[model samples]
Target: MAKLTDEEMMKMMESADNAVTGEGPATMAESNDGIAPLTVRKLMIIGCGDGGCNIATAIARKIPDETFVIAYNTSKRNVNEIVCDMKVYVTSDADEKIVDGSGKSRAYSKDAFKLNAYKNLLETVNIGLEKMPDISYIIVCTTTDGGTGSGSSPMVAKLLSDNIDVPVLLMGVYPSMDEDAIAQYNALEWQSEVERIGVPYFVLDNNQHGMEKPKVHAAVNNQGAMIASLLAGREFGNSSISIIDNRNLYMLLVQMGGRLVAAIDDARPSSGQTLDDYVMAMLQKNYQPEPSNVKGIGVFIKGSRELLDKMDTSIPEVQKKYGNAVLRFAHIENSDSVEIAVLLTGCSEAAPRLLEMKNRYDDIVHAQKEAASVIGDVMSGMKNLLGDPRSSKRRGEAKEPDISALDL
Candidate 1:
């Protein structure tokens, strides 16, 4: 699981396949370091019902080449409900400008946004299968709420999991309690259901990351931007070395912990140093790498320290394991606890390689067993509450399988 260097990855990307050394390229022919020669394929991007129309519009604008289909429930008043409000602007590289398209490649918010979100998702999948037939991937970017995101997302995940064997990654968002408790609750419910389906989910919550400023509207806008960035190939900070998108490393931070501390020009000796050098320098300046007995790299922090001090605590352990690791830290306004983010870019081959746990066949098996046990317990609880006869009747009436019986 040795992390691939940017040079190595760049070479791959420039070679036969535009791959950067990693498991990120869309096509199998291209190594992670390389990008496969552009192919015209379908990539269905789904957004939840209601305000999610805005997210769908944003996504439609970001990646223009692919055939984008957004499925949502349009029953309720949403940001998109207003006439001309959810206008999706297509970003044109011709003049480096964004302009409205002639509906051909613009945002599409259909009325079916509300008919049983999950059922609608199934219908959308069926439509895509019939229309596109040859799809690269189905990227589900939804904030689990209402019908489209909450209900349809799991169904879509299940469809991909059961029928289409593709690299289906879900970029899900969770709203804060203040935003709407109902939405928050629905998000949690959808999350649990999707987890039961066992797709590779990259989840981010509005509550986890703070905005640039304290203003409410500004924060919401920033959150939207962050989600857009993540969907547009930005990595998540909480991810392991198994998931970092190295290309994005040049410009963006995966999460709040992996902030952009410095972008040096390498004035002194650019020729001699390597990409690893730049990454290491960032870690060294911020923190000292400390080895730990537990094998796992530990980033320790004390109260009342600057960003560098917080980063210092984690670097020693990470560097010892991974040569190119970036560390960052932040202090609470009034608390003693310091938050730390350690980004490992260069894990040695000897370091036990972390496999893609979510999609592994073994993981699925384990998840299924776990889910079964949990469902058994839940059914037993239900039996206790409603009596065995009612519980048995309810079980028979259930349409979906006991998802808890499938959790890993």
Candidate 2:
């Protein structure tokens, strides 16, 4: 395709602006130059549990026509409550005979998926495909600390990755330590399974969000929706400054075992703030203790040409800081204000948290084994003291006189 000129780009943005303000159609009409207008990419959002469903619902609400959303859970009630294009209730024979929660058992959830959920998923995918035949991406959302979400997510992601032609993205929410020990264990196990499945995933740490349960849920959903919007939104402009298409996004995000982080700066430029200073400040506010193992960086800037020019100079500093990591850039002209979105891909700093959870899980298992051993020893001692009636009878040493004297 030919590069777009600055004037053309500005017109496209104006069209988008008009669309957003409801003054005109959201999509641009075909230009006289024979250039087709930008269209939102179709997405399939498969939510695995309550958390996933919540995020999916938020995304659906924001981009109802662009996405097909579905929720799957072992709990019929939970699945019933989610608002989505479809709901898939996963169940096993045991679940059908005696309905109960997975009791936070990752094993139970995995079994349910292996025995029953996969079929439902296939059917759901068929229906979704009928609605959105041109779907370009699949996003699997789940919390990695619960039975239904943690256990089934990896399997679901793997199935989609293997069967579908499009790239699959995993949006995983890590559990807070305060939730439950089982949750920690589940997260640890789920991480290993996800790694083995080898799908790219984004982690949202519930512990670090610093919100109450309800607020955290909303925050997470909003963040997920924002990321989805960024990926799906058009990055084209008239100028050949930089653009991130769906392929660019997929390449940046599909690095196996990489954690994704996005930082956004929406504040007005202060009197003394340079574009570089603003970008650095945004990074500081969003990224905690810089990741040393960074592998890729994507920078999206929406600002005036002057600010973008300033950003051009700062790119070298970013490259220097990240060392040899790959970098991608996109610039969109917006006269109202400047904004930056930074996406980083690398080995996550969540290793320490995972290790801690693993250690705690090991400690619990050890303690349980020790307790069982102690209880077994005490029971054995009591049995020895009482003597074995069967052994006594076999040895012809059984006694029968003591009860007769008292009864008659």
Candidate 3:
């Protein structure tokens, strides 16, 4: 049997869509009800500065023809230069609110670029939407802890949701204890905010994910690569085998992305598999990995004994398929169920920016906490100086207190 060429696959996709819509199939060769089969027409990667830029670049590199609109707050820096031919819109006019992702300023800490940044960001999105009417996915990769990525991403998600109806997949990075209070606070707030917006978020922890280098561009490249693969019917970690498993993972991302997209557009979604079912389906799909590609698999088992026992049954098969790919196991004390997250890094060069960011995450977090504390102290002092209720006196009864009148 001859494998389907790119053109054939596309034709099949068109046929599948026709079948699902009851318009008759385009080609009998390609018709499936799976959400992954739904073709992605356009994607806009908002907030591409710091690590977010790398994520955007990865997607840009993967799909040269796909229209990618990058929204960055740093203008003079020209982060767009990193993203090859994709269109870029930098919010140089947005206010100096904490620009998340590496705890950096969205405006390069310049007063000229401060104020109206949020509105500028929204405008960028509007332009992108207008330009790419067929956009099916909007992936916002920002730092949960830093300034621009942290602050702008949620706003973009909200504005986009309010205007267009499409899936918004937010990939946010969380800083470690090293990032300090402000960075941590910003990250937490953004995550909570995006969650409140009811968007499916994929969060990566800087502390947990080990990287080999440290550089903004490098880090994003690594993360961006993961995002591209995960979106294009590829699996992460240990679960990339069995065509069914790959399709299952691909469907999970598409379903999640589609759910948000549908909600944003105010369109009703056809009920499909629950999150639990999706995970289980992926787990059940055999790990018949390509032997040559297999290097090592890291197993993270965190659940009830029953779940562990079930996984125990499947370990041998996984080992047999990947030539001892199992690497490590992490036990979560109170997990209710099992989750097998996979990462396949087939001898590729380690992303340097990622390592730099990971190494500095804790330090940056600490600095942010100190900054927050200092601000809090300053505000408290100002409050005390301006008005102390206990020391207050009636306006007419009190004489004007003069600093010059006091003895030096």
For every candidate, C-alpha RMSD to the true structure in Å: 19.1, 8.8, 16.6
Instruction: Report the number of the highest-TM-score candidate.
Output: 2
Better of 1 and 3 by TM-score: 3
TM-score of each: 0.40, 0.73, 0.47
User: Model 2: residues >4 Å from true position, as ranges?
Assistant: 1-39, 93-100, 234-240, 255-257, 271-292, 313-323, 346-349, 359-408
Q: The CA-based lDDT of model 2 is what?
A: 0.67
Residue 40, candidate 3: Cα error in Å is 6.0
Candidate 3 residue lDDT tens string, 1-408? 123456754554453333322244222223365433232345667654465665666667766466465746443354535673333343333453343222354233223223455456666677777877766667777666666567667666666666767666776666654555566556556655765776555554454334433653354446555444444423212211111222322323432221111000111112453322333344333121112222222232334544444443224454454333222121111245344444321211123423444446566667778998997787873545576775778766778678885677
Lowest summed lDDT window (length 10), candidate 2: 19-28
* Model 2 pairs in collision: 4-238, 9-238
Q: Give the Cα error of residue 293 in candidate 3, in Å.
A: 30
Which lDDT values do the candidates have, in the order given? 0.39, 0.67, 0.46
lDDT of 3 at 160: 64
lDDT of 1 by residue, 1-408 (tens): 133456754443343122111234342244354743222344566555444454555555544444355644434335333221112222333563432212211122221222233343555566766776655556665555444456555665666656665445565555543443345456556656765765544443443224432343333323443333333332122221122233233212221111112211212324454333444554443211211121112121122334322223333433454443332221112124432233331122111111221124345567679988997787873535555663465534557666896776
